[model samples]
Target: MDVAINYLEENFAERKIKIQAQEYLHRFYGSLGFKQVSEPYLDDGILHIDMLREK
Candidate 1:
């Protein structure tokens, strides 16, 4: 996952977009520079968090 993200980051330099993932998936995206945005919240009965990587 990290390798793929690195490739995307390197390849998508002009997108100026943000990538987000839930808390459970935090570690995967974190390795690629994404940061936790806030505490977990209940969404559809599951705990969710927002992590984002800015372009």
Candidate 2:
């Protein structure tokens, strides 16, 4: 994940990145600069939430 994010930041010129992550893993992503952007929701029966990283 770190590698992919670094690749985007270095090469893609992206404004922001968004992901639907498992709710319990939010903290893991938060360490990578992602912040929760949505309330908990279910996806394919798994609890998940939206997160985003802005450039």
Candidate 3:
């Protein structure tokens, strides 16, 4: 996933976005240098979090 993200980041110079499956997945995203935006909240019985990484 990291490799794919790096490819997208490099290929899409105009658009900057990263996605994860769930809030728990934030840790994986963090490993790739993404930062959590706020506390996680319940969404359809599951937790969700927003994260972003600037290029």
RMSD of each: 3.1, 0.9, 2.3
Output the number of the lDDT-best candidate.
2
Q: Model 1: per-residue lDDT, tens digit, 1-55?
A: 6566567768866333354456688787777677788788878877777776665
Better of 1 and 2 by TM-score: 2
Off by over 4 Å in 1: 1-20
lDDT of 3 by residue, 11-44 (tens): 8762456453478888788887778876788878
Query: Ranking under lDDT, best-scoring first?
Result: 2, 3, 1
Instruction: List per-prediction Cα lDDT, in the order shown.
Output: 0.67, 0.93, 0.72
| Cand. 2 Cα-lDDT | 0.93
Query: What's the best-to-worst order under TM-score?
Result: 2, 3, 1
The residue pairs that clash in candidate 3, if any, are none
TM-score of 2: 0.90
lDDT of candidate 3 vs native?
0.72
